[model samples]
Target: MIKPSSYCNEDDGEFKKEWKNDSNSSSVNSSTLSLHIAAYENSSNSDMASTADTEGLKGKHSLAKKWKNAKHPFFGSSSVIQNSFEFTRQQENDKVSQSEIMQFKASQKLLNPNSSVNHQPGEKNMCLFTLLRCSDLVMQKQRNPEKKKHLLVKKLAKEGYNDIYSNEPTKFIYLGNAGFVCGVSPTYLQELFGKLDGFHKLHSFRHKSYAFVEFKTVEDGKRAYELYDFPAIEAAPKAILPKGLSVISEFITPEYEEELLGFLNENNEDMKNRSVLHFGHKFDYDSNSAFQKGLDIPPILDELIKSMQPHFGTHFPDQITVNRYRPGQSIPMHVDTHSAFEEPIISLSLQSSINLDYTHCANPTVNTEISLPRRSLLIMKGESRYCWRHGIRPRASDVGEDGELVPREERYSITFRKIRTKPCECPYIEYCDWNRNGVTAIPSNNESARQVEKTYVQQVYEDIAEHFSQTRHSKWNAVANFLDSLSKGSVVLDAGCGNGKYLSTKTDKFFMGFDTCHNLLRVANTKGEVMNGSLFEIPIRDSVCDAVICIAVIHHFSTVERRKAAIAEITRVLTSGGKALITVWSIDQKTDGQMSAYAKMRSNKEPTEMKQENNAKLMIHDGTDFSHCDMLVPWQRSSDGAQFFRYYHLFYKDELDALVESFDELTVIDSAYEQGNFIVIFQKK
Candidate 1:
């Protein structure tokens, strides 16, 4: 039997042994490689998926007859599918092969003599009834076999299935192929599919309620589970099953559930005009689909997923969609009913924050809201994904109930689920009036359906995150390089300084600073206890200085001519032979380099009013087409206009090298992490 609790627990203890490096399930693409910063190694979120024994949940019923001898013993859920049914034992899977999985998954019926004779004799269903340990965690399995077993079930009338859905005593099977297959042990069935939701179909012996349905394709099987999850109308005539309820919800109507499937089906008016980044499908970070815990995934994130597996009964390692939303961006309403695991979807929010909106699928006007704080997790099972749709409302500013306007920003969301359809664009676009009359009726015929899906997809987003980065450190290399340029006791000068955060850290005692601003000097002096004069002119003995070290303070100079003059003065004050360590933004095409200084001119917001260091531009024309003036900020020398600067600089390698060599003999580090900037270890002669 598939016991989630047991599997989750096992994963918990084995994480140390397994989850140190759970690599991406596929090749590390660009997007995946970019977002991985090396600074978060110590942080751990203890909720990773592990083994748990959930067999004790309220009502206990006999499993499908084929799995009669199956007991709820679990090898684990995250790294492997741990259900056993002695089969033909072909050389199927060496290390949990898919061939072996297919062996048990394809078994369609129980020939056990103790079977209930209600089954239509000789009736065959191509279904696979293998009990999978419950979990929606990513990367739970250890092996990656090429081939495996498969399951099959008869396809019934969509309408007829709906009619008999609530009252029929459908036969559950452990079938494989044709008339040839292995029958599953019953206890195993109960452990996997939630203890049978006690509903019956027409002619079903009111005594044997609820049925477990498994499709040959794991993907198809999960979607079928969600669509036909027809909850039993308890008070109606076919109420032979245990009340349908999960740890997450009471009972919700099918109509209510469909309304919640907004993400799956988006045709609302308010959602039409939103300029969001993406619309559909599942995503997760892995080299492949193996859920082996200790492989590539960091330990901290693994635990957080483990804590929620028990509630996700059968499907192990749910297909998860990992998304990143920068400031001023969001995802519209959508349903997750198409997931491959038929199990519930669980979302874990990390880094930064956002306001999440949940609304009725049928009525977009009525909505529920929650401020998804950082480090929080939300789970939607049973009716949550089917009955109630969820989305993120775009907001430029968010005011708390406390009336304090808190600054809002970009964030990362880890949405976990089992994928149903292959990742693709939304097809219903062109003919539909989503942007026109808003969800107005569009013909629902097949040809139109194809076009509807085609035109609507603006684009399918592919994530390109970083794989790794340097760890954090406190000291600066520039400090050592600066001291190296000095003699036994020569006065060293720091110039063009915004502040003296670097004053006291210089190696020898000859360090002093010059700044264009004084308020900055006050803050710096307090931190370091010393201050010199301005950079325009120096009070020290001319030609008596040994060295200087300038940090990221050059790009902000009034202009290139003025910056050159500033560097000239530093040289004028230097001894006949001395050096300097200069670090400035140097542009590089190797990475997302700095924008041209002009991109800012086009982005400047016209100022309604201006403050001390901030300016409002006068680029607006007072005529026609618009009103109230779309505000704009000034064109600062450096800074990414929108996504917030990962690093700020408009440096081109050649441009920076010329600027430095223009004054003295300076050597720029050929490969600085910041392409827009570089470190120049200079020696003045």
Candidate 2:
């Protein structure tokens, strides 16, 4: 009978001595490895057969029953089938040899049960369970000692037992209710838990609900199981699990975490389209299949993956995804397509910790939330990797087991996967990409609104973005010279920056640009940091930019206040000593001959009337007609029969200078006419 104790404090040396004596009873060769343990604690043969049948392992179970009458204590223990299962590597020769050793040991122990042996008064020693499923095949191989290994391999593959040949299994022990200790420092927990003899590595996942601790040996694991009784923390109520010595804790130094965080920050860039960069085979949404794109994985990433081989096995990841999330951002719930990638996906987190929600596709109500800590590596395999869908919720702060957990900074993650070479034969075919039978994709409402906004002004540029880019290839000499004069590493902002024409000018410094047109921004993205946004409202930190350039943009405003507002916005974003270059279309640039006809076309209303205010004249285009300062400029696409009109407020040289200087905080540095435009450089007070 097995004695269940509250604390089993046997030391490592005692266990080692017992194991050596037990192992001495048999000297088995690698050939007889495919042995099965046929005994159970309380289950009858019929009960075991029912279980095997339910699991679709009928053949394996029947083979094991054939050895039930064998007189070996090692072959009849309940632990053999439960705690003693060993994970075999995919290496073919080693797998066969190891399988044979299991059988040889079991046979030797059965034949010599009366040999001199030492046992803990009443405790049963457990033996590792071998490939019980391959017993029948091993018997045949034994009969014909000269049988080739290839034949056995072919038989095993045909029987659907190949999945067991997984990569070197990761050593992990799951901790229940880790969320109760979110306030506790990981380093403190690690130190407290490290007191247990064999604890080597420790990690905790999202919301601190659970954690995994690795040990050096099986004896250490059993010792932890018996001695470390988890106690409930102060945060948990009666409903929470009681904890005396919980199996949750581990240490990661602050210096190590900071190094990883710095790496991610250095590589991050503002993205306007997809939140992540997909490398290797790109998954096509339209066709619902993966296509091989000739992009190679970065060498640095390859080195990082290689460094993780000890923990995650020797699986080469072909697909890599890099994602950066700021505050109030999130990734929607979705599962990796079964047909697209292999099992055991790894995600490395950096900078900020976050909670991840996991749900079963078949039963959505049964959900699990895991907290991912900074600089931690998360491995998803087996049931967690295949059957569930995982995602992060959109929120600035997450409510943990105790209270809210607010990230002090941004978060980034790199997800790595090995693309499957062949068709997927996974059991969850119903939820796979091949059919999407049970899967439902939910479109983002926020993204839909953004798409609609893009159609207003963005679609116009999208129609002629490439052609317009061609006409403006050469940079304006004066603006180019000013940009070149700036010191290296000076932050620059391109307000209403389209196609990123001047982006490459600042090489050493960070250059950021924004536009309402997504199509134009896509082209600009190749040169610098460009995002989809509006000029009237800048999406950046206050007073952070060293300089700003708003060219051929202010003239597009319909009202004088709007134009003034645009200038004020630029001033607000500039540093104290920062300067800005503002330009508008010049009415003087047009020939006098065309002025009469244009005047007639715009003869509907009077020119803008204004009054002096705040030491400078207020430039108001209120009640102005469609002619004079306001006119619609037409553009024709050479590729198609489409024509579009753009609004423009032509500014005289004096008027352009006065409008900019009207802001009390701005001091005009220079004003001039250059390249059919009125340009003015001003500094913020």
Candidate 3:
């Protein structure tokens, strides 16, 4: 409970005159009254100095006047001021008696209109406790202004004052006695409030005993306010990880991580484009188990496993699976097949941190997310290994403990297990495949590739259509110049023309645009004649257009065959000798020691070099040099901090020319690197 003071500001001369008149008529002893007055006058100069530091000289004078003019209920006018001054003096000397303290408490109750305690009418109060407390708060304000504001807001809130305010729809709710000073941590608050609907973030003032919980909507805030039980929040534990599951952070050094990554890059060159690699035995995803044993584990990996044997005691792991994840890639929730592997599965994470979600097999609603930092080790056995299903959500970023977005980077994981000779006898029988006699097949290679495009490329563009359109308004100068060079009344096709930005580039030419995303087509429809269609199967007749432009579109295809088909479609719609301009994201984003515009948009922090492997389809962060030809790039929406990953098959120098040259009917007219993209102009024969 908080007791806030209310004081009236008045002129210094008038206040002094009123105080003098009231003091002469008071029944207090003359000696005691003189001592109190003298002590107050002595302390006033120092108190004013402290106030002047934060509020300036003018504010100090105003506060001084308010202190002198404040009235008391039981002791008549200005008597509370004298008693507060006396209380301050007594506190400094540490000589105040129990009876005097009791009288101060009674005065506080009388001053607080909201206090439930009843008091007799006309009871003589010897002190003004609120004024004394407010004076002390003023002293605290000089040291920390933010803390003072927090305390003041909390005090006002406790007294039933209206603190919620916003010009837009309200999404923030105030919580009293729910901050660091009240033994409530931000993580603790997040755990409690995050369970509610639409909860976004929690902001806690450490020095102030209060917090503001932000939700996704005003209704969410109102609902949370009604449902949240503040009294029980303090009693909850800090964290509750799954039983028999443990994470050891920084289990390996930076040097060791580099060494392990180097070994994987060198040995697994043939399978670099694939996300998963296996040694000792190949994992069969369809069956959710491992088979085809006798594959040799590299010498370095074997040494690493041997080093970890001390932690495992007697049971040593024999098989290893290495998984590489792009920013938005994810593994579906599952328990390792019981009959295929023994207990105590271990995994090591490298290069980036990620959240692993665990859910009870019996209850879908019971789930928790835990972070596995880079270079960490995770070991699972018993209930955690059998009864809990673990998985990672497909996202480019995760919400941090402090309620902020933490961007993701490329990550690598090494998992170790021993083949089981007998059936599993674990206590958790409900999830055991041995008891259930269940088997599942793996998806085909082509279907898996298509799924990547569907999730990372097609779905991403559709979700971020509005925001993407906003950022892509400016047309490229080269593209605009090419459109201007076209003959007047020439029929033109803008394949994959997102938002139809280039359709109106040449008003004299007849332009038609087409895109795969309906949301983008809707935006484009407002600009010019646009239709919803895919680049692979353009809805146009052969030789119908005089010119065709496929700007920044071909790279979205996951495979070289699909990219070739897109190029063929563009050629099929062009007339003889018709020109086409194609641009793809370039592997080299820097020229002559200067970074391109795309790289410049990234943070100024020093970029980390990615170790190269054979055509690896890795995740690439902005501003970093490309280590793989095919990669996933992240696009973050500013409005809600939602991140989407876009797949790109970047081209190296001479690669686009080589691709166009493969078609004898097409002749490359000009080629150059511009603005982090490879630009190639070709004409149909």
Candidate 4:
């Protein structure tokens, strides 16, 4: 009765009676194919329905939550491990036919030689099942040339065995307990299976329909993810994973050798020793026109060159480098280690997009090739950029006639780098100061990690229409909502005005703003005026405006004194009992709610310090104010919303009452809490 996707072995009989080979088995197979659905249905304590009208809790990622729960505990739970194996064996007994077990085990051994047993309960079932970076573990692999793989291939399908490389064929391997691991040759096993410390292979693929992969430790599973993402396969561009485990016979068409030969002859370099083709490579950063390769690079590529100037800052000394690719030529595994990457490498893909193989220098074993779509601007720094390297691999199909990875295709990328920066040092650096050096300043784990405190937090911003705004899109929403409730010609002023975001809202032409940052206001040019001003001192007439609105501004002040001064300004600017709609984090969440999580993390000896790349300081120092720190202090836990604040100011019912009583004129009318957000609407009486 076993339908095979359960991947449980035959001897153990993991499939249940009546359910074995049941029509429901196909549905279960389809369900297992989708890890998110499986996790949502199977996992306990997950909130499938949203009833609590928590303000920020609206649409969170359910898949992310599923991975955390499914992966973290099973490795430590012996009971879970035992239960998984027992479940597998029972399922095998119920459904999987005996004939499939032998081929499945052989395939398992070839892919991953290591196998062991578990007496533990509630064991992890799949990867993509657990790994955070990996969305799913149900990846299908191609067969090796010798037909040695014990694939779960459909029996009637045999299409393209003649075209596969005789030397190195495709083979599927096991990635811990719940996931599949694939390797090219015997040598790839180390890279594929070596990272899984606690995982043991379930060699007996009961159904041979799907393999049951188990992890001994969640860390092992994470490492597996760090190593074996489908994108990582792009690291070897020549090797493409076709869409799922389908019959290549049905999909693949025989290539005419003469056509391939003609294309090969056109290539300037000899192809004798090459294993794969590369479609992406920067032949010349300075090539303003096109290369001798004579690729018809898209005209829209002009925008990519222009975008670099903004992100690379003044440190970008030269025009960005550009590369174009056509089907069948791919760059191999290599590093673009140049001083140009002083900040980070920002690339924009246009026209022909490609797959980028990003691999860590420290963990060379870890790699992934995320797809770069046309017109997608990629901001890659730190681990995926400086600490590592990125390149593009070429293949035959850019997109199949059906519009998928066509085994090879044409692709192009524009990489804008900041070659000139405060001399920082990298391995390639000569003698220099912060301006002259580059990647070397970045602390390595081997190096004594220095505490890189932020003089000011660098908030990632976006420009909707000439006005700077948070890419998160929340601030704009908050501003628009505030403006809609107001009367026309209301002389409103945005205190702590960041880049005139509120002014960009479609409000009546009477909105003015004042900010601590003069540079931000210079371009604000609102209908009234945006002057350089602080909350402690308002340059405006008293009681001139009917309402004052503040959003995501008060959280920057770490201490209570700064908060009080800011509050006093709001009260002073208001007319007697004038309405003030403000959104500050609820402090109640920080005290009783957050303190425990922080204490728990610190108790585990969490590292106390961190570092950062200083692009442009978000907040300029007036030379007298306290320095700003990164959103999260090491060992201090704060949700994304609370990270900017001293603590989550989740106001308790009593706290709101106390504030209202103290102010006397201000009354809290309604409040709602969601996720990490607290929305309170106040009315002036």
Which candidate comes out best when scored by TM-score? Answer: 3
User: Cα lDDT for residue 298, model 2?
Assistant: 62
Model 4, range 310-354, lDDT digits (tens) per residue?
Answer: 655555323344444556666644434434336555665544456
Root-mean-square deviation (CA) per prediction: 26.3, 31.8, 21.6, 20.3
Please give, for residues 365-481, the per-residue lDDT of candidate 1 as tens digits. Answer: 234555555655666654445534567645554433232334666565555555433422222221111233222123234443223222221010001011100111233544554
Error of 2 at 240 (Å): 84
TM-score for predicted model 1 compared with the true structure: 0.31
Better of 3 and 4 by TM-score: 3
lDDT for model 1, please. Answer: 0.35
Pick by lDDT: 2 or 3, better one: 3
TM-scores of all models?
0.31, 0.30, 0.40, 0.35
Model 1 residue 43 lDDT? 7
Which candidate achieves the best lDDT against the true structure?
3
| Candidate 4 whole-model C-alpha lDDT, 0 to 1 | 0.36
Candidate 4 error regions (>4 Å): 1-94, 97-100, 103-479, 526-528, 585-661
**lDDT tens readout by residue for model 3, 519-556:** 99999998899988889899999998889888899888
Q: How many backbone clashes does candidate 1 have?
A: 128
